[model samples]
Structure formats: C-alpha cells, structure tokens
Target: MIRPSSLIFAAALGALAGCATTSAPRSGAAVAPYRDSIDLAGRIAINYSRDGKRESLSGKFTWRQSKANTDVSLISPTGQTVAVINVTPSSATLKQSGKEARTAPDLDSLTTQTLGWTLPVSGLRDWLQGYATAVDGKRFVATPANDSVVTRDGWKLDYVSWQDDAAAVPQPKRIDVTRIALGQQVDEMAIRIVIDPVAQ
Candidate 1:
C-alpha cells in the first residue's frame, strides 16, 4: 500500500521551466541551495498512481519564482473547483470554495494529509540546478546528469532523467527521479515530470 507521505515526496519530482539556481553556499551545504527563477504559467498535466487508484489532475498554474509565493488552483474531476492557494516563504493562505483564506505556517502538514501531496518545492530547486540527494546502501545510478549524484547521509540517487539545457522550464525535455531503498521496506519509487514551454 502506498502511503500519503510518499505522495508528499512525489510533488518534489516535477521539472521547472525558466528557473535559476544560486552558487553553492560560501561554506557548508545550504538548506535550500537549488534556487532557480522559473515562470510556470501554462497547461500543466500531472499523472500519479498510488494503491491502485489513478489520479489525473490538469490545470493552469503559474509560479514566477520558486513557487514560494504564487496563486495555485486545483480543478476537480467533476469540473468543480476544490481550492485556491496562495503561498509565501513565511506562511501560506488558502481559500476553499467561497470560504475565507486560512493563514498558517509555511510548513503545514495539512497538504500532505488532506491532498495526499506535499507543497512542491525544495527538492526540485536542488534537482533543477543539477544537484542530487544521497541514497544510502547498495544503490545504483540510473541517470547521471553531471556524473554527480546528490549524496545526503549516504543515499544514492539520480534523476532518472531531466532537461539537459540551461533554460528555465516550460521546455523541460527530461525529468525523472529514482530512489534506492537500503534499510527501508520500500525499495524504489520512480517519478516522471514534464514541462510545457508553450501551452495554449
């Protein structure tokens, strides 16, 4: 059975268009090193399957920067509107239906539990800049962009694929994620992300 936390992690897999990254921290590894300025405005489609339930979510989203502060909306299967979200670095305000917007901490767990997904950020920021996260124990490299896999705490990971260009998203030709499970019960999870530079 697929867990919800896993879904939260899934949000971290999409590729960004028109994004930018900053130089490595002056000293020591930075918390949010992957900094890219991408304009995510277009018809974005995402497909995810968990526990045998297939979910198809398609809509228009625009992220001027790192998705830190932007307007996001989710379209329901029945052509109904579910929610509208406004996020910022310090906090997040959400408006559902005709209700008022609720302001909460930036790190709200409600998203992962209620939506079966996490706020999409961070990981992609790092990934877009060609950085990798570590995967501990007996792991293999699936797709190496810079011959460097992000090694965090000893986990071996590689973007199964991703855009090989320096261009910010919308035209992300390649986007994939692979995780090697060492001491965990789950062995692996594969995620694919696509960006449409020109969407009508």
Candidate 2:
C-alpha cells in the first residue's frame, strides 16, 4: 500500500502537489479499506504529484462489501510500474518486484498516507453519471450537505454541452469545476480530475 503522507509527482504536464517515500510491496496479500466510508470499482485515470510536477496514470478498482477486491495495475509514462495494490475486504496485499507484502487494515491507511492523497470515491461515482461532490473541507463551487443548488454537500457540478448524454448525470469528462473561493474560472486541480481521475 502507498504510504500516506505527502506526495511528489511529475504528471504528463502540470504542477505537483505532495510527496512521499516508500518501498515496494513485499508479499501479495489482501488490500483493506483506506477509509471505512467506501468501496469502489471502475476504470479511472489518476493524476497526482511527483517532484512537484503533476503525473497521470490509468487503472481500474474492483471493490465489494466495503472491501476492494481487484487487481489494479498502473503504468508510468516511462513504461515502468509505480506500484500495484490488490485490496480485499478483510486483508490487503501488494506485489512489487519479486516480493509480495500482505497486511490487514493497515493497507488502507498505508496506501493513502503513502501516496499523500485522497482517493477519488465521489469523483468515481459521479464520473459514471458525470457529476461529483467535493470533500466537505475542500474548496469547490459549493457544498453537498447544505448547498442550495443540490441536496448534496459538494458543488452543484453540472455538464451542459451543446449536446447531452442519454444518461441523467453528465459525464464528469465534459463538466467544468469552479472553486467557490476562486472566481468564475474553473479550478486547475479539479479540472485535472474531471479530465483525468486522480486522488484529491
């Protein structure tokens, strides 16, 4: 699992956010919850930080019963592996190099802390429908719990292109994000997630 702390990423092209130092997984074990609130599955693009530069990668998460049961593989632009996390409801495991590391609930905190980022659960769900809510503390166009526009706490994220999707929620791909603190301009970080899936 990624050691949650700070992260340093050199994305395809963008500014970096946080930094972290970690060793590869030792054994292939079960991956536990990074948080108790969610389990997710979908094809996603993760954009993050390395050496203060933004980085991007694509992968899929398979989760069930509050446990992530999936084989996720991430490939760096250079064609090398950053890491692969295999998560299960009860336990977690990772395979790096030739060794595998298996652990329990530790995997959850470890991954997020190691990566120094928050996995995009809200984004992933909304991505399917093309709408998402921001974390309560994070800045955005609005809130979810008490926002006037929507019943949710996150921003009233909407996608209104010249065309619309047959699906009810617009795909996050086309939707633009405006930080509440900021002006009309969309947020670079949020937009980055919209175009590409990444941890917040």
Candidate 3:
C-alpha cells in the first residue's frame, strides 16, 4: 500500500497561505490577475527510491483553494478516486478510497514523520502560478529568459513550458521538480506536473 503520507501532496497544495507574498512584476512584465480562489486540474507524477527500491506513481488531480479552505482529489488513470484531502488553517485531513481518514498538524510534519522528506509547502502555491519564494523569503518570477530556480528549501524547480508564449506574462503549463537533499533524509526523488488549461 502506498503510505498515506506519500499521497499528501494535496495538503501541500492547501498549505498555509499566510506565509505567501504576492509576486511583484519585474519591470515591464505582466502578471496574471490575482484571484481569491483558484481551481485547477492537472497531471502529477512522483518517483523516489527508498530502501534500495524504486517506486513511482502518476495520476490526475483536481484542486480547489480559497482563502478559507482547500480541497483536492487524486484520481487514477482508470478514473478511480485514489485519495481526497482537505486542509484548513489548523489541520489537514487525508482520506483514501477504503481507509480511515488521517489528520496532521501540517504537511511538513506529516510527510517528515511518514516519508522522511519534506514537501515544498512554503513555495508550492506560488510555484503553481509560475513564481517562487525562496527560504529566505525572496520571490522569483518565471520568465522565458529565466525558467529555473533553486528554492533553497530542498527542491529545484524548472518551469518547462508556458501556456502562451505570446502573452504579456505567460503562465506555467509544465513544471519539473527535483530533490536537493544533503543526507539520507531524502533520496532521489522527482516530480513533474502538467497543468490543464482553464476552460472557457
């Protein structure tokens, strides 16, 4: 069984937003309009080596985030509900198709206790919008000229493609992430995300 915590990427999606700063546009660059809530559907893949064995998972996900709450659903390629996660300011809950729901104080603690690694909870929300906030709290915006950033928070991110190259500020369509681990706490791990375009 995939350990439940391995599937808590949804909690990371709903991580605390109080720490996030709105991205500032670089001179002459445009940014997507800010919305109080965001809804997205996409593909996600995770690969990692543990106990000398390699494991991988790939699936589709739907995410809904608002100021007050966030809900995420992980779906298998065969269209089965793999897991569902709900997160709020105080707690996070994960429920798989046939298992009891698990709760945690936050994603970092949950994943650390279960997976021996940390998710980029501090930076993921910004990353989804093509921006990043490093551990020191500096913001990096993605542009064609500069598409990769080492977040200094244990991961390196690459904005592989954009939704519209001709737009004033292109939004990320695909993102690649790799672990930057110093010790055994994190082994070789990689994640790739491909975001679906918003429906008209």
Q: How many residue pairs clash in each candidate?
A: 24, 53, 0
Which is better, 1 or 3, measured by lDDT?
3
lDDT of each: 0.41, 0.32, 0.69
Per-residue lDDT value at 100 in model 2: 46
Which lDDT tens digits does candidate 2 get at residues 126-170? 222222233443312211222222213333344433122333322
Each model's TM-score? 0.48, 0.37, 0.83
Tens digits of per-residue lDDT for model 1, 1-200: 32343233223222232122343432332232344444543333444555766654444434455544544454443444455555566655555655555555543443543454553333444443445444432222223323335344333333334334443321233444444345442323344444445444
Task: Order the candidate numbers by lDDT, best to worst.
Answer: 3, 1, 2
RMSD of each: 8.1, 13.0, 3.4
Q: Taking the tens digit of each residue's C-alpha lDDT, what string does model 3 give over 89-108?
A: 78767777667777788656
- How far residue 80's Cα lies from its native spot in candidate 1, in Å, is 7.9
The 10-residue segment with the lowest total lDDT in model 2: 12-21
